[model samples]
Target: MPHYLGIDVGTSAVKAILADERQNAVAEADVSLTVSRLHDLWSEQDPEAWWQAVQTAIEQLRAANASAFADIRGIGLSGQMHGAVLLDENNRPLRPAILWNDGRSFREAQELGAKHPELSHAMGVIPMPGFTAPKLLWVARHEPDIFRAIRKIMLPKDYIRLKLTGAAVTEMSDAAGTWWLDEARRDWSDAALAATDLNRQHMPDLVEGSQPSGMVRSEIAAQWGLQGDVVVAGGAGDAAAGAVGLGAIEDGSAFISLGTSGQLFVTTKEFSPAPEAVVHSFCHAVPGRWFQMAAMLNAASCLAWTASLLKRDIGDLLRETEAAYRSPSNVLFLPYLAGERTPHNDPYARGVFFGLSPATQQTDLVQAVLEGVAFSFADAKQCLEQAGTPLTYAGMIGGGSRSAFWARIFASVLDVPMVRYQGSDKGPAFGAARLARLAATGEAPEAVCTAPSILETIEPQPQLVELYRPRIEAFRNLYRALKPEFVRA
Candidate 1:
């Protein structure tokens, strides 16, 4: 009874899972759709509406696991990471898929980090039009005939692995969050494909997010009932498949993930880049490692925008602010409602509340939205512990860890120990069903992610780490005194 599929492609919808062999969940399906923001920090979608929400969530998960997709063998594919997805020469889709919580490609990611500061000093990174090479230089400067009908360029699971198996490929956990990976030669970055003329033969075949790269579209596996040769592996980059579904593939293991922008990651064997490039050193879905993230464009989406301006129900406003998680709120939230990424990549740093008053309640705005997503993930875990990368323990997956008082205020503001996973088919479909059970058996990516287990573990309360180390040094000096008016906002 093999079964192993884990599609994900998320950020609104399309989830499909079947997983068995130890990864459990014999069936699951999802389909939601709705991303087109049209304006305000635009965030489009519609790649045929994520291919009809992944063919109606794989025909309602193969009609409720009819013999579980006929012993589905291999499949893996996680997504939603610096999206940009573009393709043309008949591979179709040329517009709409710009997500990764679009921020109007912040001046096209600063003319690609100022015409590539050596692609961020040699593949430490620069691909930033919310990535995928500054959204292909913002569609080669505002749709130059759709960038002259570009042949390929994918993300959003390499455009659904080129619609499942027509293969245009991309892996290395979504090619090290595209800026043209070279996270120290993990692959492709011939000086960022010759400084963004970017046509490494239309860049695609990068592979290694697990393995096997073909077979799946035999008439869309009989229009979704499956039972046809599988193997669609080599998938990842939904925060390294939610750090292999919260197992954080070894190393000094860590995970913060608070979805819709907010990650801390930090597993490493080297590939750092934080010499003020402010955290982000890719490559890592395990195989020959590298990771040093640190995002946080906004966590728990400013407590879902202060639960829609206090209209309530963020679980009844965290049960009317569960005693400010054991009291202590002279408030000070700068979770940067939107505008600010790892260590200050200021998009125009806004969000604040910094020391509100009148006895601030709704439990001090729910302890300032769980202390501003634990002080912006404690400044992305201090930019991966100042590039020495040492997180030792923390695997707290998303939907902002369904708050147990914001998971004890992110385990006392990252004083560490947040290994959570109250399981609900989290991130990258539990890391693509344990990398499709380590590609059907040649195990050991930490024994198929600790036998798909770890369901609960959130420790950290030494007097709430003695009340968050001097309020994490006044939340890292309110983002360095609001970093020069959040870069002139």
Candidate 2:
């Protein structure tokens, strides 16, 4: 039987998986990556590092199951969105890739939004520092020599695609996050690109996520092992790829992705722009669908950070905190470690533990960190509702979804049913695999992109809901109270 390959160029790692025709993951491998934070508000990675990691991950997958790996007929790519990878005329990276979480371009983002007020709806979201366009503006202003030498720009995953298939192409879902794609037209917007001193010539060819973008080069095929013509699908941004993985293709399908960052995403039948709400409205991975998302910069990473700081293993910390759980935490943690996006849109915001007393223990701090992330999602839920897309129920995915305790907290805080699926934690890699199958078989999306089998549905506990209400308000008020302090510092 033929197999498909899915590769995700994530912020923290490069993950590759082999999926059989039935959509079951046959084998997988992950190689870790590190980010460079040489200065405050700056996050970067060498593009070559991602390529090296991808190569290593593929080799590991091959070693684990050489037969299945050799049988692979198609490949799909997924990656962190909004990264700016500048390439010179020879297609060499001019500098380290500026990542999605990087906040060094706040001034450029504000200037773009202010100067092009009418373009916000057209671009689908207000120009934020996280988007690719503003980062380019920052480069033009700060690194003019590199800007002048730029011949092309690519997202993180597409950089991998260049090595795999030698094609300069991107899909709607990923391009939508660049602040250059016209959401309605599903094409690069000249006006938006012009605002950043760029044109369509600097952009990649655009395709739908389900469509075949290129074929794997013969050299790569020979390097891996025996394979026929292997096609490369136009994969998605991480969020859209996760949505595809969960089969969230129709209108009203929703899910919360609690990865390094978090997104409360709801699918829409048409292009819906909610710039004022600080909600991201962008094209879905599947054709002719769009999604509205409230995105936060911090989520599972907060727990990881806290665990590292306290010198405890994450699983042990979570288990200890769950065993000691009672009511809501008396201490409130503002999970703005890397800064915030939805609602607040404040890059200067820093993490804080308010209401801490001498009585606070390590468990209390851990519990507060978990609740703080949940509370941030509550803010996201409200923002999505304000954008006219209220989620009644949502499926959960990403690394954080492995914790039932965290899921329960989210269910209670959001007052909605949270559905967990088998293999949901596999996240964008699984979704990219499905896209691989589609591109290889030329199958209809409705036939192949069905939701995975349900594991369990977590419902909101009435008592816990009531208990969290006051704390949610307190969380919001604390942030409001500290807004000025964050800016001043």
lDDT of 2 at 323: 98
Model 2 misplaced regions, further than 4 Å: none
**TM-score: model 2 vs. ground truth:** 0.99
lDDT of 1 by residue, 1-489 (tens): 787888888776778778787677777888887777777666788777777788787778778878877788888888788687777877888788787667667787787677666567455654444566766777678778877787777788768778878988878867777777777777887767666576577888876777777778898777665675888877788888888776667666777788667788867776667636477878887687777788766777788778888877788778767844565577877877657767766666777777877766776876776787787777777777777776756766777776666777787777777766666336777687677667656577876775234667778878868877787788778778878886676
Worst 10 residues of 1 by lDDT: 121-130
State each model's C-alpha RMSD to the native.
18.7, 0.7
Best by lDDT: 2
The TM-score measured for candidate 1 stands at 0.37
Query: For model 1, what is the error of residue 143's alpha carbon versus the real structure, in angstroms, after optimal superposition?
Result: 8.2
Cα-lDDT of candidate 1: 0.74
